[model samples]
Target: MITIWGRLNSHNVKKVAWAAIEMGIEHRRIDMGGAFGFTDDYLAMNPNRLIPTIEDDSVPGGFSLWESNAILRYLADAHAPHLRPEAPAERAQGDKWMDWQFTFAEAQRTAFQGIVRQGKDVNDPQVSASIAATIKLAERFDAALGQTPFLAGKAFGIADIPMGVYAYTFFTLPFERPSLPNMEDWYAGLTARPGYASQVMIPLS
Candidate 1:
């Protein structure tokens, strides 16, 4: 059996769970690393002390693993390699979008929380700078999506998985968002996916 350890509320954890569902990888999920708190046995599973650690007993070598993105890659290549992309150029392009999500969208989230989630006025010079960054990043992505339906190209794939989860945070943030028609449209389509809705889109706490 495959055992997954993580708080379901975590976005990174959600990504892995979402992929598992899409690929139909049956596994048991354990509650830990949040309100459950970590125990020594949990430490045995992941020294990093992060949510989203998994132990797989069914694989050839039978090992455990951590790191959400790596888990996504593993599951994709193992069961749904089509989503992972076989062509070198397509894979490289997919890698770029994945990196862009972390480098651009995820990085700006701290600012999003400060101004949007915390319900502070986003007009202060510092807040404006941060919001501006988000807007600029969104625009860049809008331009990209204007060309392709998914970050990895026409097909929804591994790269879209991470980026799609990040969009949930953007949609839920409490502030006036810049015009991002393409992004909004893409996110809407993402919401239509059963995997996305099942693993993400729970009520915000």
Candidate 2:
């Protein structure tokens, strides 16, 4: 069985676990990050000291992987290549949005931290600015979803997982959010998926 190390509350870790569940991969998860501290052995596998590291004993030499997206790709390549686009150009279309989440997160992080973690003054100039930027990012996603049924086009794939996790936090937050019908519909579709509902749609802690 594959071994996964991370806390369920982590968004990055949720992505990995969601993928594993969606693919019906047999694995065991260890509660390891955040309040659950990592051991010295954990540090050896991932020097970055991040959550959601995985050990796949099935691979030659017993592969250990770090980085949630890398783990997503590895699982797809190893078990379900159908989860990714077959053509290079099509794959790139999916890749662009998957890569875009980090940049999007940088814009959204301050407001999320302020609103969810610290309960900072929502009207603070910095917080308001961050919220505006995050809305703009969502508008971009809304526009993209208008064209394709999924981020990777017609089919659900790795591209959807990152934003899928973010959408839960974004929509449920108490902040005033602009209504993007297309984005809402897309998110509704995600909520219907068993993997997304159980793994990605948990209460953001």
Candidate 3:
């Protein structure tokens, strides 16, 4: 069994937990970080002090891993081949979008932190600037989605997990956003998945 340590409300944690459920992996998630705080053992496992660390006892000597995207790749490569594209080139497509999510997140960080975490006014300069930057990045994502049904191509794969997590926040933010039909449609499909609904589609906190 895999032991995942992180609070459920964390986007990174949600990615790992949701992927585990989608892949039918037997694992248990323990709430840690945020208000729950972290233990010395947790810090030892992830020296960076980040949420969503995983320990897989199934590995030869017990393996602990960090980094949300890396963890997603490991889980897909090790346990769920279906989640990964078979061809190297095809797989790289998914890899690209996975990496892009960090950039996307960074672009929206100020707004998300201000509005979601601190409850700052949406019209605040920094918040509005961040939201504008996020919209520009999201437009690029929308264009990509317009060309392909999924980020990686025709089928939903690991590429969708990170962005799907963010999409909830993007769509739910209390501001006017230009409509992107492709992204909206893709997000709609994600909402229908039991794993996504249970894990990603939650009250933002």
Candidate 4:
């Protein structure tokens, strides 16, 4: 069995947990970040002090991994090869989007923190600016989705996991957003998945 250490509310953590569930991997999760605080041992495993670190005892000597996207790749490689495509070119279609999610996150960070964490008004200049910037970046996803049903091509894969986690926050934020029909359709399909519905589509923290 593998041990996943992180709180459910964390978007990064959610990616790990949701992938584990989607791939039918046997694992246990412990809330360790945010209000739960981190232990020295946790820091030893991930000096970066981030959430969603995993320790897989299934390996001969045991293996510890960090970085949410890296963990998703590892999980796909080790336990669920089907989650990722085998052909390099086919896989890159999804791989690029995995990295792109970080950009999307950065674009929205200010708005997310201001409104969700700081309880600032949407009209706050900085918050509004961040939201606008985030929306602009989202157009890329909208355009990509228009060509493929999923970011990872015609099917959902590792690539979809990262953005799927963020889409919940983007759509739920208390602000009007320009219509992105393709993204909306993709998000609706995500909600239909049991793993996404249970893990990613939760009350935002």
Residue-wise lDDT of candidate 1 within 31-96, one digit each (tens)? 888688998998987888898988778788887889888888888877788898788888888888
Candidate 2's residue-wise lDDT over 1-205, tens digit each?
Answer: 7898999989899999999988889998999989998899999999888988999988888989999888888898897788999898878888898889887878878887888788787797878888899899999899999999898888999889988888887887677988898999999999999989888877767
In model 3, state the lDDT of residue 33: 95
Show the lowest summed lDDT stretch of 10 residues, model 2: 166-175
For residues 1-205, could you state the per-residue lDDT of candidate 3 as single tens digits?
Answer: 9899999989899999999999999999999999999899899889887889999988999999999999999999899988889888878888999999999989888988899899999899999999999999999999999999998788988889999999888998888899999999999999999999998888888
Residue-pair clashes per candidate, as listed? 0, 0, 0, 0
- Model 1 clashing residue pairs (backbone): none
What would the per-residue lDDT of candidate 4 be over residues 185-205, giving only the tens digit for each residue? Answer: 999988898989898888877
Q: What lDDT does candidate 4 reach at residue 140? A: 78
lDDT of each: 0.80, 0.88, 0.91, 0.91
Angstrom error at residue 123, model 4: 0.5
Where model 3 places Cα greater than 4 Å from the true spot, the runs are none
Q: Give the clashing residue pairs of candidate 2, or none.
A: none
lDDT of 1: 0.80
List the lowest-lDDT window of 10 residues for candidate 3: 150-159
